[model samples]
Every structure is written in C-alpha cells, then in structure tokens.
Target: MQKQKTGIRHMFTGTLPQVVASLTGTISAVNDGMHYGWSAPIIPILQSDDTPIRISKTDESWLETMYLIGGIAGLPVTIYLVDKIGRKNSTIVSSCTSLLSWILIALAPNVACLYVARFLSGLAGDMAFVATPMYVAEIADQKIRGLLSSLIYLMMLFGILLIYLIAPFTPFYVPSIVGSLLLITQLASFSFMPKSPYYLLSKNKVDSARKALDRLRTTKNNEAELEDISRAIERQKKEKGRPQDLLLVKSNRKALIVMTVLNAAQHFCGISVMLMNMHSILTEAGSVYLKSTTTAIIFSVCMLTAATFSSFFVDKYGRKFLLITSSSLTGICLLVLAIYFNLKTVGYDVRSVSWIPIACVMAYAAVFKIGLGMVPIVISAELFSNRVKAMGMTIADAMYLIFGLLSIELYKGLSESYGYHVPFYLFSALSLVTTVFTIVIVPETKGKTLEEIQMLLKGEKPVCSNDDDATDNLTQA
Candidate 1:
C-alpha cells in the first residue's frame, strides 16, 4: 500500500508540465487581443474623427488608471472566491468576465464605456495571474513543479507573439472579437476541465478529490492514489491555517519574503515594460512603423526560443541557477543598451543605425522568459500549503499587479521624460539586486514534493519514500 501510494505521487511529477499547457488556448486569445488591439487598429480607431470614440491624452491616462484600479480592487475578491468556489470554477467565471469586457470594449460608444471595458479586463487579468499558476502548482508533483509552473509564461509568450502576428494585418475590431469568441469556447469547454483535487480535499470533499485525481491521472492504482491523497489531506488538516497566520509563522515568513522579493524583481526586470511599448521604443530608435513591426517579429521569435528552451531545462536545472543566470544576462544587456542611449544623447547622429539595441532587447526578453519571467508564478503557488494557497497567491499577485501598474505608468512617463536608456539602467540595477536575493534565498524544488519543499524551506530534511532516484536529476546543469 505504501509503495503504491508513493508511485501515485510520482505520477504528479509527470503531470507538472501539463498544468500551464491547459491555459494556452485561453491565454493566446486574450493576450493577443489586448496587446494587438493597443498597437494596431485601436490607434487609428481613436484618432479618427468619424469614429464614435475619441481618445485624448486625458482619455488615455484615465483608461490606464482605470485598468490599474480594477486590478487593485479585484485581488481580494478573487482570493476569497477561489477558496470558496475552487480553481476551475473561478477560472471559468473570470474568463467569462474577460469575454464580456472584450465585447464591451469592441462595442463601446464613448470613452466612458472603454474605461469600463478595460476595468473589467483588469479584473479578469488579476484573476488569471493568481488562479492559473496556483492551479498548476497544486496539481503538479514537486520534481517538475517549476517546469509546470513555467507553462503560464510560455503560453503568455505565445500570446504576445500571436498578437504581433495578427496586429499588422487585422482590423481593429478583429482581435477583440476573436478574444470574445475564444472566451465563449473556454466557458463551454471548462465543464470538461477537472477541478483541482487538492482544493477538493482541502474542503473535505475526499470522494470528489479522489474522483478528480483519478480523472487527471488516468493510470492504474486508483485505490493507492486515493490513500495517498487522503494522507496528504490529513497532513494539511493538521496544518489548517489562514494565509495571514502562515505568513506570520517563522518558517513560512522566509518563504513569504523570498516570494515577495522575487515577484517584485520579475516586473523590475524591464522586459514587461518594453513589451507594452515595443512600437514606441522602436520609434524612439528611429524605426518607422514597418521597421517596428519587423523588429517585433524578430523579438517574438527570440522570445519563443527562450520560452521553449526554458520549458525543456527548468526540470533539469532547478529554479535557482536559471534565475541567477538569466538575471545576470538581462542586467548585462540592459547596461549595454544604456551605453547606447548615452552615446545617442551625446550627439551621435546617423541614419540607418545598427539594430544592436533591438537585438539586445530581444535577447533579454528570451533570457527573462527562461528564468525570472516564469519563476515567480511557480514560487508564489508553492510557498504555502493548500490551506493558504489561494490567499498566498492572492497576496503575491496583488503586489505583483500593483507593481505592474506602477511599472507601466512609470515606463510611459519616464520614457517620454527621462529617456529610454534610463529605464533600462534602472531595471538592470534591479536585476542585480534580484540576482543577489535569488542566490541567498530561493531554494531548488526540482523534483521535490510540496510537503518536502515546505519542509526544506523550513530548514528540515525532507524524507521521500518514493523516487529517491529522481533527486539526482535536480542538480543544476
């Protein structure tokens, strides 16, 4: 019985990689819609006198602020509901809300309606960030947990790439319409998507969790898996605690600190800001629209490489090494770009300039996707036990989305006022700081169980009854 239980747990390691993959379909549609809409037809739509909607500088500022405000407002509610409703159900609701937002944005008659649409989108965005990774981590076995968590970022990169592809050719309404349609599809199909068995067990729905476990696993040993899940649930019930309580505990405090710092650092890495304003950055570098579009494609291609390679290596290399290496690489690239900007400011004028900055930016994006871009999401979910998973993720995401708002606002204003290179330099300095933190704080969870990882984080030795051989695979490459 014990051996079979261990074997069933081992299956979770294999299940890790599939977690983020589940959301790819939804991610690709919404992400493309949001980014592509902003860069492509929306601009023309807003600028046209014939159009019913017109966006002034004031309108743009208000729209952005509304989105940020919505995120701040939604986090607490999402945290509460996820615990009450379960991961799968929460996602279905959020995705549906997002679908409605897209439709509203597409059919909006005035600036007021657009703000409401964006606000709704912001709510869904916050939900996705918190719920998706949490769902992935809860379902994943420890061995490849980091790799599984990375799927969100991988899917996100694909989302961004799809946007770049569709933006240049499609009409303004096309992306939003597509996003809405995809949302409908997701809502319809989610009936088939199983709820997180972990959540079920947490709620004492043991029979249901077992059924979900069976469906997700789809292998032999149903009785053994049920026993293992029951044991895990028993352990969790002993630790039954609130998110705030766990965060205040001495051992869990360290996990909180590490996760918080890492989450902040992920955004501070600057790739996100750059992505949000890719066209504007290219324009500053003297690239016209056509050239800017070409540069976006190149950047996306490089990012895709980083995403693919990271997915392959995350399980092999562990999280810490990849994070440190990627941070160092990103920092160096930012510093170089800073130098380029300094030269330009000092009066180096020539047309048909080298595309060095563009290339460097692409490389930086790729490196980020491999490490920092994906690590925070996984870490946040893993930091707490099931009792507090939703809340922990909620707090982490709240901080993340709040910082995200600041980052975007700062990027928009600072790029216009201080200079492009300055933001890169700032982000580079942040990356260095984050690298130091990663080395000193973050632990490797490659091939480790959630309980084992929690124990490891608490400075206790984790005893794995099954898959002792798997530990050998966790060493950094």
Candidate 2:
C-alpha cells in the first residue's frame, strides 16, 4: 500500500510543472477564441438599429474572410518566426499582436478599421496555433502529451464560451476590453515559463536546454532525457529543412498528406460557418422557446464541456477512435439538421418541430468537440519531425484557413442562393467523407513519444519503449 501510494504521489508531482507550463502557454488560446467567437454575437449587432458602424451582409462576410486572409498571410511569417525566434518568443509576439488587435477593435472609427483589427487578430491566432503546440509538445511528457496538447483547443473553447456569454448583453467594446486584459494576463504569466527544450537544443544551447528541461520536469536528474532530446535534434539537423523536404522525404510526404486531409475534413464540416453565424441561423429557425443569443450561449457551453471531457479521454481512448467516432456522429447530426432545413424550405409547416434545429446544433457541438474539433490540432503537433515541423505546420495551417474561408463562403453563397439546407447537406456529406478518411488514413498517435511518432510516420515499427531505446534509435536513424 505504501509503495502504491508513493508511486501515485510521484506521478502527480512529476506532472505538475508540465501542467503549469502548458496552462500558461495555452492561455493565449483563450484570446484567440475570443477573437474567433467575436463575430458570432457582434455581427447581429452590426446589422441592428443601435449599430456603431453600418455593415451590409457583404461587409459581414468580408469581416470573417479578412480574418482568414490574415491567417493565411501570417503563415509565412509564423514559419519564419517559430524557427528564427523560437517558440516562446513567437508566442510572446503573438500575445502582443493580439493585444493590439483588441485595442484597435475597442477604438475602431470605421468598418475598415474593424477589418484591419480582425486581420491582426487572425495573424495572432495563426501564430499562437503554430507556436504553442510545438512548445507544449516539446515540453510535455509523452504519457500526458495528448491531454496537454488538447489544452490548446480546450482553452480556445473556453474563450469562445467566454465571448458568447458576455458579448450579447454587454456594450460593443466590453468584450474587446476583456479580451485585451486576458492577453495581458497571458503575457505576464507565460513570460516566466521556460523556452521549449527542443528549440533551445536546436539552437545548440545544450546547457540552456538542460535548464529548460529541468524547469519542465520534476525530477532533478534529467540527463537521460536531455541526451535523448540531443540525439533526436542531431538526427533531425542532419536532414535539410527545405520546403521541398516536406514532400520529397517519404515520412514528411506522408505527414503532409495526413494533415492536409485532416485539415480539409475539419473545416469542410462547416464548424466555422456554424460558429460565426450561429445566432443568424437560430433566429432564422424561429425558435419560440428561446432567443438566438441564449441558444448561442448554450451552444458554446456544450462545446466547451465536450472539449473538457475529451481531454481526459484522448490518451486513454487513442486519437483514431475518438476522431472516427466524433466524425461519424457529427455527420449524423448535420444530416438531421439538413433534413430539417430542407423540410422547412419546401413549404412544410415545420412549426410543430421548431425545436429540432436547436437540438441538432447543440448535439453537434457536443459530438464534434469530442474528437473532430480537437484531435487534428493534437495530431498536427505530433506528426512532423523537427526538420520540417515549422514548414509543415504552416502549410497545414494555411490549408486550415483556406478551407475555412471556402467553407464559410460556401455557406453564404449556397444559403443565399438556394436555402440553408443546401450548405448543411454539403457539410453533412463532407463530414461523412471525413469519417472514411480517418478510418483509413489517420494513424493512431496516442501515448507515443515524438521519436516514436516519427518512426511510425516513416513506416517503421516503433521498438523503443524507453528513453534509452529512443536515444539508440535516434542515433541509428
């Protein structure tokens, strides 16, 4: 009993530093969430009688597209920054940009100012997504890496929920003020966290890398782990990090394909469209029992809750299982929603089933977050070797933004031309396609070390079960 108790206590102590570092770094995601979710509540107000700046439907769509355009623009900058400045500094830069964006939003004089502010926010969000995952993945213990990595999406969901809760009732500028304050808080707190050991080692600062690793791990003796990291870094450095390597190298090619498909599946499911236009969709549904704002709040809350629960299961259940299940269930929900919207569009008296949209959307929030919404972020961080990680992630992120931009536009164009059912049906079909893709293409990565994942990506069996073997494999590879 005493031995068992000691083991449990040691396990808890070992994970504490990792947890703290992850929380501090990922807190920036809350601000990203706020910026992403900001559109949902504010767009309706922009079209209302008490609007500060007048906006037509075209202008509103531009607001969303501009953010995505900015995200695409930021990808090249992020690829450069994450490698040149290191992950921690990159995140700090992201925080500063996010703060500036909120300030601009808070003090905007015209629609152009609003567009520019959103563009900056998108840039910051892209930076955070690229840098924070690498930082967290490099610092975390493999045993809990999935959970720690999932914190990125979990924090994002919290931010979304936060904005959803406040934006409807508060004044136009209140959410921006709150978002700015949170970014400041992240800057202050995360500034004290150590740089990623991988980044430090890549720069040939062995002593600094050791110190950073020490700060992230509870055990005083991390020499073995340090050596393992050094070996891996050395192996990766032997390969040229050219952009062509992302496709020329077999493993890199595989990782890119997997990520491209995953990103496509993630965005084509209409999550961005659903989130950005939730209030409008609900209002159009004509729900007699609840207001659109209230339903939006509930939608965000359900997403957050589902994401929170998913973090606990990611490592245990494995990434492939959760993704397949989430994708399958999400398609079903979307299909149901498509049917309901189609029925309403066909001049049917859907008044008797008015509550279906709410139920479908709420259920979609839960099922989607359980896997499809969160796992890709985690997997993207794990897939690439250090050689092409930055470039690979940037390309994947660009794909994510592009797909998002296209999906949102598809929603707007299809809905305006045909009806809401058209877009929903398209989203539902894409989601089903995603399910098949995950079942065949996406590899299971739960509980694997960075080295093991690379080996798996290379089509080699992972024989290393411990740090010593991982070091041997790195040296031999």
Candidate 3:
C-alpha cells in the first residue's frame, strides 16, 4: 500500500491569505501619508467652495510640522503599547486614530481643523508603523520573516495607489471614505486575531505562548520545533535580563554604526518623498501631458508593483547586493531626471521630456524598493542579538522617522525654491554615498542565526560563515 504523504506544508501556503488581508489593513491604514502629501493634486476640490481653504506654502509648512511633531508625540505611546498590550491591540488603536482623523479632515469647517485632523492622523499612522512590523516579524517563522515585514512597505505603496485612484473622482471626501472603510474593516478583523505570543511570554504566559506557537506553526510535526521555539524564547528573556551581556552592551560599535547608517541611508534615498509627492514633482519638471491625479495614480501603482517584486528578491539575492545595486540604480535614475530638468532651463523643451521624468521616477521607485526599502528592516533584525532586537529596532525606527521628516521637509522647500533638479540631485548624491558605505560596512546575514551574526559583527573569524556553535546562547532556553 502506498503510504500517505505527511509533513508540515510551507508557512506561506497556510498564511498567505491572512497575510494578504493583513497587508490590505496595513496599506489602507497608512494611506493618509500619500493623501496629505499629494494634497496639491486635490487642491482644486479644496478650493472650489466659496469659502476655500487655500493649500498654500504656509498650509504645507503647518502640515509638515504636524506630521513630524505628531510622530514624535506618538512614539512613547507606541513603544509602551507594543510591549505592554502586544502588536494586535496597538494596530487597532492606530487604525482608529487614522479613521477619526480622516472623518474630521473630510468634513472640516476650516484650515485649522484640517491641520489638527492631519496631525492626529500622523500620530496614529506612526503607531501602525511601529506595531505592524513587530507583529509581522513575530508571527512569521524564521524562514519568511523578512518578506513578511517587507510587506508593510509594499502595502503602503498600495495605499498610495488607492489614494491616487480616488483623488481624481471625488477629491476631499472620497479618500476619507476609503480610509475610514479600511480602518473599520481592520478594527473588525483585528479584533478576532490573537495577541502576540512574545508579549504573552514576556508576561509569563508560557502556556498561551505555546498555544500561539502551535497555531502559528500550522502542523502537528511542529511539536519539536515548537519546543525549540519556547526554549529560544526563554533564553532571549534571560539574556535580556542580564545587564552586562556582550550583545546587550553594544558589541562592536562598528555594527551599531553600520546598521544605523544603513537605516538612515534608506530615507536619504528620497523614496518616501518621491512617491508621496510624485504629482507635484512631475508638474515642477514641466510635464503638461499628465494631470496631477493621473500621474500620482500611475506613480503609486508603479511603486506598489516594484515593492511587491522586491519582497521576492530580498531573501534570495541577500541584503548587501540588493542595497548596493538598488542604490546605484536609483542614483542614476535621479541624475537623468536632474539633467533633463537642468537642460530645460536653456530652452530645450522637447515634447519627449515629459515622459522622461515619468520613466525616471518609475525607475527610481523600482530600485529604491528592491534595495533600500526592504534591506534596512532585514539588516536591523539580523545585526543585533535577540536580546537587543526589540530595543535596537525601536532605536533604528526612531532615527528613520526623524531623518525621514527632515528629508520630506527639505524636499518640499528645496524643490519649490531651488527647482526640481535640486531635490533629485541632492538625493542622488546621498544615494551614491550610501552605496559605498553599504559595500564596505554591511555584511551578508543570509541563513545565519542572530548569535552568529553577533559573532560576525565582532570581527571574529568563524570556522564556517554559517556556523553559530560558538555563540549558541540564542539557541538555548
């Protein structure tokens, strides 16, 4: 008799449907950033009323301040909530914040209300950024965790697409309706989801953590791996409790420097600003063929597709190669756009020039997502030990948001005052600088355990690159 085939299937097959749903929730929740950043494209609707709220330079300035300031305000809450209540609860709260902000913004009586609503939304949006990654990383198995976390960025791009698609048809209320619907769905769906086992384990809920591990593992044969996971969890807790642990003490300030620089390098590439404000940037470069709404939608769709592909390659190609290649390619694309815009100054107004900027924008988005967008998160997880992963990720994200704010603010004014060429050229130069830094400093972490990564960061030569027998604390309970 033929024996029945029996084994645990891949986690992706069991989880892909849920992953897609979670992806939609995340994308919809964060869509507000694109909505506000491209407010210029929706300005005509905002102004059509008799008593109009002019989206002026002053308004944009206030909006920018609100975003950065609000994100700062939200961090303490996010940090406390993510560890305390677990990732699921924090995401629900964040989604509600976005929902409330959009409703108020859509029906605002004045410019002040708009600013306040956007500010609140920014605070909520930041919380999602913090919690979603943690949840994705926690729920996913070791094999596909990077790809799952990368989905956060990928879904954010889709949110951009939704906004761009809706902006043209019904300016102010449509995007708000879309955002609110997404949040309502998320609020409902996330209610049924289980709390993170990591948080439960931290609170001494080992039995619950074990159950969650079982459910998340999706197989009977996972019993052995499940026990290993529980032990690993215990080991991480003990390691974290030790005050003077080598990994906890910031082993090799050089690794800290490497991860930190790489993290900062991601935002400095101008990926967020370019995708968020694509419409205005294209218009600034003298594109007359595409309307702001159409351009914004196209740009958003391109970015989403590019980011989706990036998730597939992230693990296969390894982080370092992608970072170096993606950065250089992004820089080249920006330089071409810069050159085209600069040439326009001397009366070289060719009809084909319009599409050049569009093509360049797509090219830049493709490369940025493939390298800088996905790799930093992967590197952040791999660079430090399990003991430090939580705090290390927090620090990295904080810096990312801080510099991210600066990049957005700088792009807005720099593009408006200096010309379209200025922002793109500056980002291109920064990308080139980061490319060199990545090649020299960042090491490959593919298929290596966290403890082994720590050893590599310490500059200790290993018997084999993938061997981690020397630093097995992570593998113990």
Each candidate: what lDDT? 0.70, 0.86, 0.67
lDDT of 1 by residue, 1-477 (tens): 998676546545445324533553235235523532353435545676765577887886677567667777898879887888877777777787787777887788788888888788778777777777777776655555666676666665665666667655766567677677666776776557667777887778888877777666545455664565567667767765666665666556777788778878877878658766777765676644356667667777787788778876776666788899988888888888777776787778734554766767777878887788767766777777666677777777777866776777777776679888788788889999888988988887767767677778778887653243745343121
In model 3, state the lDDT of residue 217. Answer: 52
Report the lDDT tens digits of candidate 3 across residue range 131-177.
77766666664445567767777666666666666675664677787
TM-score of each: 0.86, 0.91, 0.82
lDDT of 1: 0.70
Candidate numbers sorted by TM-score from highest down: 2, 1, 3
Better of 1 and 3 by TM-score: 1
Find the candidate with the highest TM-score and give its number: 2
Give me the displacement of residue 56 in model 1, in angstroms.
2.1
- Native-to-model Cα distance after best TM-score fit, residue 27 in candidate 1, in Å: 4.7
Candidate 3 worst ten-residue window by lDDT? 1-10
